[model samples]
Target chain A: MENRNQITAKQLGVFVLSAQVGLGVVGLPSDLVKEVGHDGWISILSAGILSTVITVIVIALLRRYSNQSIFEINRHLYGKIPGQIINFLLILYLGFLMVIGFRYFTEFIKLFTLKATPELFLALLIIAPTAYLSWYGLKPVARFSGIIFVILFFFLLLNLLTLKKIRVSFLMPVGAADLAALGQSIIPALLAFVGLELTVFLYPYITDKRNVLKWVIIANLCTSAFITIIFLVTMGYFGENLLKMQVAPLFNLARYYRAPYFGRVDLFFILLWFPLLESTFRSYFFTTYDCMRRYFSFKDQKLAYGLYAALTILLSRLPKDFTQATQLGKVVNLAGIAVFGFLSLCYLYSFFNKRGVKAPCGKS
Target chain B: MSTGMVSCVTIVVSTVTLIASLSLPPWGLGLPARILKFTALFFAALFGILGLIVTASVTFAHLVTLESLGQPYFQPLIPFKPGKYDRKKRP
Candidate 1:
């Protein structure tokens, strides 16, 4: 049966876009510059291509089952014990993503805008609304993604003012990073695109299911294009060596950018970031809440959302400092890689079983 | 005020404003969404300004008990009233 709250393909694309952007895009240029110079954009593009291929494999695996969520497919393909264990692992990953994403936002705000603000207070200021919004369910969240996509355009506009500072010579040594360096940057770049796994859960709730792959790939390309522009601009403005020292190259673009009768563009960009950050928070929490609901067979969704939000906020306090928070982020991305590996294995088994049986596939 | 006092005030004021903002839409009252949007924005701005002043408050445990029109306003932001407000009565 089709879900009444199903989102359209376009909205799904926006959801994927919002999920991937998060706070990672702000620091992406600096992080990549340390390794690949201007060729960092290439690393991001390669990661996008990799994500698309993995997404296709995930979609193929999903198509083998009849509209069942990944959590359900886990139980059906494996025994109940292993299935629950896998589901719990996926839940843990989503929980970790939520906590880390929150930490990143709080840190960014504290560093740039509110240097003396308490971490717990800032975390609540962001998480409270995000959890409240998640309570409204996927349809509202999908609708909110439309707003987030529009807000992202404001970042591009603010970024354009940095043109005055750009130097063509900075990008003259384009391939300076070499193939090996570019290859090394791919895994770190993949961390920025970790949320693509959202599709495995979102597919069943998407309208126009036939075009899911097309929309998702478009979303990936759009995100890559956006991040690439930021990378290009940052490299041209600061050069690779200077860019490496900056924490958030994209936000820094706004620090120097000036327009007619206006300044402090960085603060403006940060203000607009609430919706974008909240959208990412909601998407991860959706997976977390959905997993909890399925695991416990909980009928009261409000209670489930509350528990998820509380646990997420609790976990956010565990990281000792910014370095530990980032290390935890790397660990979570590694766990995400394992989850994708598991998905690929599921697909391989399905494909071989289909060939062997010669029976009509995708039935429950 | 001291740092701790500022945070305490920030959380208390923002919490009250958040409840008001969450509840003002009056989905039960059948108010137009535009008005609800404006009202919510007003409260949200108030909440944001107050929260910005403190920026370092504690957790959000108080929101759990907040309600709107006799309904839990924090989570499950929408109530499950089937066939009451919609053509299709699926909760």
Candidate 2:
């Protein structure tokens, strides 16, 4: 029932932007600080560039196949049995991502604002809305991403307010982290841009195909710029050592600055960040459901959604606490690395696979 | 800040954006529709101030009711618009 071809390339830009800037960002600056000290921003920029180039390659592969998603393309190149196995792996990885993302947001909220609330209760609050959005399908999710784009501007403005206490010297010795550390941090830094993988499944649905490359690259650059500014601002305010010690450094930066008319700006930012989280959930769930719909041939999409949500909740509960949840997240991040590597191989196969042998993947 | 202060800021920003986006020229607007728009924006801002989840839910719900270029707000999801689907396939 999805009118997949109705989404404009510009909307695709917004969707990618939202996906790239979700829950991982909540802890990213601090994590980067720990790895590369004052040079964390360098790693962030490198990761952004790496993600952008990877996205371009994925888009190139999609262009060769016209209307088929990466899922169907895998089927074309690898045949049914192997293709379905790849999709099964992809689906499980996405499920792990959703559960990890859900746990991360809940832990952050429980730690900062809702200390008395049960973590499961907070997790349910997010799951309810994300389930509703995912049940509706991709266009609603895309439009929701566009709206989140606007809210991000407000978030930026709030972040800029921290400039009141910016110390220029704190960002000193910009490339202080050695080359080995900077290189090592790139993999972890990529956690922020994992959403770029959505481009693989989403490319065929783009309405204005000519603008696809343009908008997607632009979205990549936009996220990089935003992440860069946040890194610079937080580090300039708190410096690398202080930032490393703080959990959720960006939130803490916002928390320290207060205006006469506003109370706890960080809490306000967290509240508005809910939709971005939902968009993240929707992106992963939609991909998981698409895998099911494609391989299992589930004509009933809602049935797939129900099964996906149930699985996500059950897996999400397996991590008994935040520490275990983070460990699970690291494993999911490893899966992300594998998935992208597999996609690159799939792209290579698609180039050699003849056009005449390509199966019809249906309407875009 | 007190709840009243947050509500006041929310109302102002929401009202300003609503007025700017309204297609009806300020000189010719119906009072009831105008009031409805204001109320809707106010609650949206309030929901935003309350938490991220509520703000997102409210925004998504509002967007679903809208249309642009004769297409539904969620055209890709809904797909019921006439002639909107009549475009030739890309070669």
Candidate 3:
């Protein structure tokens, strides 16, 4: 058994929750409103429950065996070569997530603050620290990561100032909504909770896996609830006017936001964005590095950062513009499902062959 | 270097847009101009010093404000109206 690192369970929960929720503040409300109209919050709530159940299944699956990393379990249940192959496919999916997160952060800043700044520079600014941080390890990040949430909480409180903007009239009784249309929004909403499954990767590093279930489920629940509040507030302030706007609704909300003394929310978002964005980038960064190392023996941290940087830079360059991003974003979302859902099912199938454990996903 | 790059880009883009707004004249751009004007009023409350310049350059047809443009830091920009001696002229 390789000694990974010790991080307290509380840190794990905070890390996972922040990773999943960071700066989801932007497109979450925009996409949700496009489908469920005013009741978009309901769709987000449902997606959160779905994510909790899926996260619990992943955490439970990882916990069932004693002291083994997910990679070790992959080999345990499914033999050597096949397990390694599945691991390769899964890591590639996480690599794609790195690209999406980086591009979204860069594109967002471009549209709002620096209209003329090239994205590649922004991408480098983020990736350099992310590679350095994840390469450094979790606890160093664990301390400052709490500060990002604090800053995000302060930003979330800004919405409290904007609460007066919410139209009780707009919150009008279920005026009209088609179930099919609202259901269409669920898949993308699920992507907002995407990093919850990192429990499988972090499981090895978690010092006390006992009662891991409580924190895992609670983290997903908090992430979901926070994001739903964000969507409701943002779309409520602007309504369907946001549905047509191409990027970050929160940024637009901030742009128009004014206080009696302090002023626009944009300044706060600019000052604090790097940390929140860093949490998301590091989650994907470490998850991909862990997965890649599982299949291919890479001992050096420098090499890990080098591989991740090259891969993300190449992937970020794939889309030429925003139009292309939409077309590819769907593909990335589907890839997310494969990594989070389908691959978990593969692990479930292998576990099923022995001891006849009750299938947690339920019979299809 | 990164901070400077980000600021330089922001100033450049805002300047270009400011020039475009000047050319369009306040009432000419229709709905968009009015919306842009309304947005500047909010920025004015928040950013303070730059807010008036932003609003004047974009939304208002007249270059008007009682705020000082002759403070040591304010005099460099060519677009500003220098401060007057009358206290009544100050905001």
Candidate 4:
């Protein structure tokens, strides 16, 4: 097969939005309220700012390798053997992420819907569709991602409407509610924004790679702000104490209805997330596939499927109990991947001058 | 893909997958899959089997169960306390 590298700008934006929505909307908010009290939104905003800065830094590095994906850039900058090693490290990092992402969705389902079922089932339930989409390729997956992005934002809007129910008194005295706890909370909050790295490997698919920075920074900002507000509204409507007490506060907040037409918030949140989950997993599979293909020369997509299945199954099992899983999951926060050496690679690749064909500063 | 080609692939793939999905125990499919996924992305065959297992398990477990299940059934809920809503209200 010819080297297949083609992605539209719309697809890139959708990919960005999918990465943002997948993990953050469901879990990022709880810690914010738990740690900072009413000012949890502030931490979210801080985390968002940090995410954007990091995202921009990484994008600039990727742009420096304008014509190359993260895998190709590494291969160029480091050469075959060492580059393959870097690629393996990044793939492992993302593979771990793919498992965790699968676990996150499964855990959410188990917590809210199938309390009696084995999580392996729920984990598998999710990965099935994800597998099909990954096999289908990224463009189709991303188009669906764009559609879900709109719906996710709408859920946020609906969630905000519920905010009128919150007592202003519940939101007062916002500053430094618990400085130490809030400081610690930022780590996890930052982790929720983990998918930004997806953009790093996606440069090759992107049609108008030149416009990547503009959409990328914008999507990151808007997505962060939207989620930050959603977190705040969920907290404001339910109060920090109550919000932190629940699994998905935003869902419960949307469910807290008195209108004659609807009875629950979770059903809507669940329906909306169905597609978001697909796109999220698709990107994870695609990026990992690209990295592995370039590094290990693992060309068989079936093998990729098998690896993903095992990772999720094992990850889903590790939480020997639900509490342990959530704790371990929380421990694997936004900055977690960076800690695993992605950040080091970014600096090294950029510093070593693996600049793309027409890089940002023309300084490859 | 042509309907004929698609149908042929689906039947061929599903037959093998049906066997794999049924034969493998929970968490048992890990080792082989790990080596495969470690090197590249997924093949439709393995993904199909996983899809079947997840769907069958979820539907069968629920249809057979006396009560609804929640997230990662074996894991403890956060805070390790059952919520007030875990039980339906008397009202």
Candidate 5:
């Protein structure tokens, strides 16, 4: 019988896409517009290219030890004590990512749909489903992500309705953004692509070892293309000045159009988008849960799930308002980048050491 | 009709389901499997309660945005499907 934990290469692609596309879709357009004018698409494209390179590096490193996750690889390369420390740090980082993404999702819901719902309750709504889905492990998460990926495609198609109202001239004088501006935009753009590094943890669970790289790269490209199209549409519809003022441009794009039956498409869109949002949240939640279980060698799985759920709910509510939440996000983004760099250094260390490279027979 | 009643009903239903489901199992479920079932049921209850709370708290403008099976849940009311509800034209 096939291993229950394993997912197909295509599922892997969808998994990464689902993870990368979440909170970024809501706010990325306005942020990019603020930083790069109409050339935000260009900045997103460049960030995509850069993220693809990092993904390739990550895949290359994982390829060396096909059977091991980064956790086990860390243990093997750095020895037990140091490896556990790095693993603990990785767990903390994953937990922080979960907290930040959870807060962002809840905050968006409060701002647009449920204005009166406490953030703590909103966080619980997401956390409950996330904890449930993650308890089964990667296979269920992967399957759910595949379903979300299809929904995401339909969401993207809905954007095309804005074409009638959009002024292509608004994106006129393309490439008007100077090189320095474009350069500055890449940091935020790169931040949008932060979830791609999830490939490191997902590498081993993927069943098709040979094509894992291709799938991950394809996933990143899909995300890049998805975000770029969203930016282009939002920029065309709202222009530079108006786009910068809107917090979540994607929702505005939905609101700009009305279907025959539904009056507020944005509200409908948010309802549809909730599962996609939850799918992304669950991905990070599962990763944190898995990492914690591995690090502590927890025998009681229920306790682990409860602890993680409690920890994320408590920590996610720390930011008082949008400004503070944005600041917290910035810290997480920087920490994500630093974690990626550290992973690369670990890859390099293993490459030169040769003797440290050993493929453990079982899963981490 | 109060929001509190809806929340109470949801919480009670969810709690009952969660408690009852724990006993009706295969009994041979390993620790992980048992946890999986518990997690699913626990969240189901929590979501039911929280979702009802949100449903009660949000305005009708926001509530009508929800749909079931691709059809507007509050159809012919919020959307005011006059054609669908035109009693004057009924033969």
Candidate 6:
């Protein structure tokens, strides 16, 4: 029987794109500028290449056990006790990602749109829809992501309109930064690509296994190209010194544009981008909920959903302010790097152990 | 109140009414079903009254989650199916 929950390779591609290009895109150029000045686009491109390579390794690992998710694959490769420990750690890492995403999103909303709204209430506003969507499972999440992905094109179009104001001289000093600075910038750039690792969790659900890697690589490249364009535009518009001081260069770039009828384009941009932001949050929130459910073996979906929502709400409020939230985001980004390393090590271990290979038996 | 505030209040009230009408069955239902329906209505009202953007966003999210015969209701509208709108052809 065909599984109703299965998503096509195309849906998977857009899902990855939506998840990878969240609130991070807003601040990524600024963060990279701080490290490498005008060479930030180079860092983004390099991170894209590195992430594509990692995607290959991840797909190769998952293809070994094509029927199982990363959670089950962990158990199949390692012993039961160790595998469960690893699964728990994975759950914790996903939870931290969700919390950080939530914190950054709420902080952004508070700063830009709803200043008087309490952080806790803003968190609830996000989690309300997140919980509702996640309750149905990954298929709904993937479908929602595909829809949001279409809306993201408008963002690109808006950014393109700002090209008229950009001074090419601002980007002239490119490659002026030393290789060490460019290398340091790559870590922050890689952080923006963190959601691409979700491929492991999504691999088993994909109906067309043969094209999964191709679509995934395409998604990663698209994200890289998209962010690189934004970075170049931001740098071109603001130059290095001014761009370095911006906390959210993408928004500022949008704010720079003046729509004749709308007056402030930034407000309209925020309204358009709101769904994409929620989509990103939903992607991480769904994955975290899925991992938590599997780890605890929760039978009641409502119970699992309720607990996760409450936990997210409480934990997201831990950051007292925007700076603290940014600090927490940095911590999560480092942890994301660590998780990527751990996944690569698992692949290596599986490669050497002949017993780790399994026949394609379909879903666990 | 200003015109914007009046429009916001009208939107919230209309949303709450629509939610209650849609969620609650006219035929008598069980206590649990009634409570669940009322709770959803309450949330719709709360989100609507809190902020216009939040209410609109939450509604949009909810609308996307609606499925018909196991297929996304808004699939063709979103995710943009150029010619394939036949229900039987989907999936």
Over all chains combined, what TM-score does candidate 4 have?
0.72
Across residues B1-91, which tens digit of lDDT does each residue of candidate 5 receive? 4555566667777899788768657766556556655655564465543363333222222333345675555655433356868777644
lDDT by residue (tens digit), candidate 6, A204-307: 77889888889889999989989999898888999999998988887887788887756678877776677788888888898787767667877787876787
What's model 1's interface RMSD, roughly to a tenth of an angstrom? Answer: 7.8
Q: lDDT values of the candidates?
A: 0.72, 0.74, 0.66, 0.63, 0.76, 0.79
lDDT of 2 by residue, B11-88 (tens): 888789788766666655557556665655674554333344554475465566456875576765443345455567
iRMSD, all candidates? 7.8, 4.6, 19.4, 14.3, 11.9, 3.2
Compose the digit string of candidate 4's lDDT tens values, residues A283-311.
Answer: 77667765665566566767765785566
Off by over 4 Å in 3: A1-4, A343-351, A355-364, B1-91
What is the docking quality class of candidate 1? Answer: incorrect
Q: Residue A237, candidate 2: how far off, in angstroms? A: 0.9
Fnat: each model in turn:
0.03, 0.21, 0.00, 0.09, 0.03, 0.42
For candidate 3, the lDDT comes to 0.66
Give me candidate 3's TM-score against the actual structure: 0.74
**Candidate 5 Cα errors over 4 Å, as ranges:** A1-3, A358-364, B1-91
TM-score for chain B of each model, two decimals: 0.23, 0.31, 0.27, 0.26, 0.27, 0.38
Q: Highest DockQ among the candidates is held by which one?
A: 6
- What is the C-alpha lDDT profile of model 1 across A155-274, one tens digit per residue? 877667677778989888767778899998987788778777888877778768778788888888888888888888888988879899998887777776766655566777776675
**Overall local distance difference test of candidate 4:** 0.63
Better of 4 and 5 by DockQ: 4
Report the C-alpha displacement of residue A84, candidate 2, in angstroms: 1.7
Q: What lDDT score goes with residue A150 in model 5?
A: 55
The reply for model 6, stretches above 4 Å from the true place, is: A1-4, A359-364, B1-50, B83-91
Q: Which ten residues in a row have the lowest lDDT in candidate 2 chain A?
A: A355-364
Q: What are the per-residue Cα lDDT tens digits for candidate 4 across B9-79?
A: 57778888777766656665766545544322333244333333344333322222221353322212311
Q: Judge the docking of candidate 5 as incorrect, acceptable, medium or high.
A: incorrect
lDDT of 5 by residue, A120-195 (tens): 7777665655666566667656666655655677777887766788789989898898999999888888877888
- Clash statistics: count for each candidate: 1, 1, 0, 32, 0, 0
How many angstroms is residue A338 displaced in model 3 relative to the true structure, after the best TM-score fit?
A: 2.5
In model 4 chain B, the worst 10-residue window by lDDT is: B71-80
